[model samples]
Target: MNVTLFSKPDCKQCDFTKRGFDKHGIDYVTVDVTADDSGRQKCIDLGYSSMPVVLVESGQEIVHWSGFRMDEIKALAYLEGAPQ
Candidate 1:
């Protein structure tokens, strides 16, 4: 599984998301939306008006969401059939 976190500076939700991932030991790539126009465009394209967006890619499946979703994070941390 590949995880990408799209975030901006000084975003509390982004900080929470990063801390959650860190606490769960989930390695993810960070994309700074403020630093890159393309990254910011991605958030807009995804129809998100939030600070932090999480994109997850597992094989042929791709999932994405915005905000600090601990439920989703927990599910990702303990996904069935995923390599442990």
Candidate 2:
């Protein structure tokens, strides 16, 4: 299972999103779009303009969302059959 979070520095929403993931004990890889070129390109490729883009990928299950969405976060956090 892989969880990726697209974020940037000095972003309040990004901080909120990260804190939420931490609080929920959801391990994830954070991609700083403002720091890395590849990360910025990925955000563009994914058609995302928000600060925190959460992507939960595991085999056939590939779900993603932009900004701070607690509902989505909780869903991914409690997803069954997902490999930790």
Candidate 3:
């Protein structure tokens, strides 16, 4: 499963969220909105007018959290292993 995190540099919440993902050993791609125009557009395209948005592989969004909740993220990640 792919996890995409859209964030900007110097964002404390973004740093905190990344740390949670790292602690969980989850592999995710980070998109720095300030560094890439396209990345910023992508975040806007998702209807998120804020930073630190997380997109799960199944097209579900777990966003707008001040900090990453491990249990919620893990539950979403575990959905990848759910039987169809």
Greater-lDDT candidate between 1 and 3: 1
Which predicted model would earn the best lDDT? 1
Q: Candidate 1, TM-score vs. the true structure?
A: 0.90
Q: Per-residue alpha-carbon lDDT of model 2 for 1-84, expressed as tens digits?
A: 899998999988889889877877888999888888888787778888778887778999778788888777777767743333
What range of 10 consecutive residues in model 3 has the weakest lDDT sum?
58-67
User: Which candidate, 1 or 2, would have the higher TM-score against the true structure?
Assistant: 1
Tens-digit lDDT track of model 1 for 1-84: 999999999999999999888877788999999898998898899899788999999999999999999988888888733323
Query: CA lDDT of 52 in candidate 3?
Result: 83
Mark the regions of model 2 whose C-alpha exceeds 4 Å error after superposition: 80-84
Q: Rank the candidates by TM-score, best first.
A: 1, 2, 3
Residues 1-81 of candidate 3: C-alpha lDDT, one tens digit per residue: 677888988888788778877766767899898898997887778777777878766446444332455665666546644
Model 3 RMSD vs true structure:
4.6
Compared with the true structure, the alpha-carbon lDDT of candidate 3 equals 0.71
Q: What are the clashing pairs of model 3?
A: none
Off by over 4 Å in 3: 59-71, 80-84
Per-model tally of clashing residue pairs: 0, 0, 0
